[model samples]
Target: TSNAEKELPDAFLRRCVFHFIEFPEKDLMARIVRVHHPDLDQKLLDQTLQAFYSLRDIDGLRKRPSTSELIDWIAVLRRAGIASVELEAGMPFLGALLKREQDLLVFAEA
Candidate 1:
């Protein structure tokens, strides 16, 4: 609407198309996780997904980790030979999830 009309240039708006999407539920998140880590065990995938949700729920994060970040983090952990997801063990790998130094520092103190 009105806000978009005023904020976006008419030329740009004419060429742009938009769609609204519902946020994916837990089961969809599980499928996304599996897609990125096909060989990951089911139990581990579930745990990883829970960790992702928990991380997103943290208060006052500068840039909360999203599903795409979760995939990258899981890949990094897998490469590091992490067989299970523990918050402490995964702490060092937050760079893959968080993009901002401020967010990393805030997360460390959490």
Candidate 2:
């Protein structure tokens, strides 16, 4: 009985985490570019490249695309620029992630 009651808090917390992950379901065709602050590190950009290579080495399916994810992906896609629907869209794309402007700030650092 002690174990059973203790498990509820853990179970509830886990579900809360999962819900956060899936919330604000992405708009798959949205195009985006990330305008990092001018002082933003080249290293962060470099790290983003490393992450992209890892994804290409792993993805085995046609997948839904979100705006920020697409911007990262264009690097991996490289000179084969024709591969990006987001690039074809060509405006400075940021996804409609916000129900309000407040939503855009999640990615921004103070």
Candidate 3:
């Protein structure tokens, strides 16, 4: 359950069983997103997922945004009435996904 396994004591780690989960692929992610935002526009959802995966692929991100952040970012975009065209042009509500200042700068550079 811990993201920082290296920070835990060796003795503590020995007592625990680890199971790592990979990030969901696009189709799987779409289904997960629909569970949260059933009425989201398909085009917007597609664009959002594309941008989300791209962001995750960026190297040297301090804290890569996770599934929960993706959901929150999409919610903000929908509520703010952002268009899919705008999302395609550039990411909106980026702060909702990227929390670190350095990470945002890294993403901007990318």
**Residue 56 shift from truth in candidate 3, angstroms:** 0.8
lDDT of 3 by residue, 1-110 (tens): 66542588789889999888888999999999999999999999999999999899999898888999999999999889998888877887899999989998999899
lDDT, candidates in the order shown: 0.75, 0.35, 0.91
Kindly give the stretch of ten consecutive residues in candidate 1 with the minimal lDDT sum: 1-10
Expressed as tens digits, the lDDT of each residue in 1-110 for candidate 2 is 12322455776566554322331222222211234223323443344334333333433322323344645444434433333334333312233222224433432321
lDDT per residue (tens digit) for residues 1-110 in model 1? 32422487888778878666665788998887788788887766776777777778878786777788888888887788777645445554778888888877777777
Compared with the true structure, model 3 gives a TM-score of: 0.88
TM-score against truth, every candidate: 0.77, 0.26, 0.88
Number of clashing pairs, model 2? 1
Question: Between candidates 1 and 3, which one is better according to lDDT?
Answer: 3
**For candidate 2, what's the RMSD?**
15.6
| Residue pairs in candidate 2 whose N, alpha carbon or C atoms collide under 3 angstroms | 32-93
Provide C-alpha RMSD values for all models, in order.
4.2, 15.6, 1.8
Error of 1 at 81 (Å): 0.4
Stronger candidate by TM-score (1 vs 3): 3
Q: Find the candidate with the highest lDDT and give its number.
A: 3
RMSD of 1: 4.2
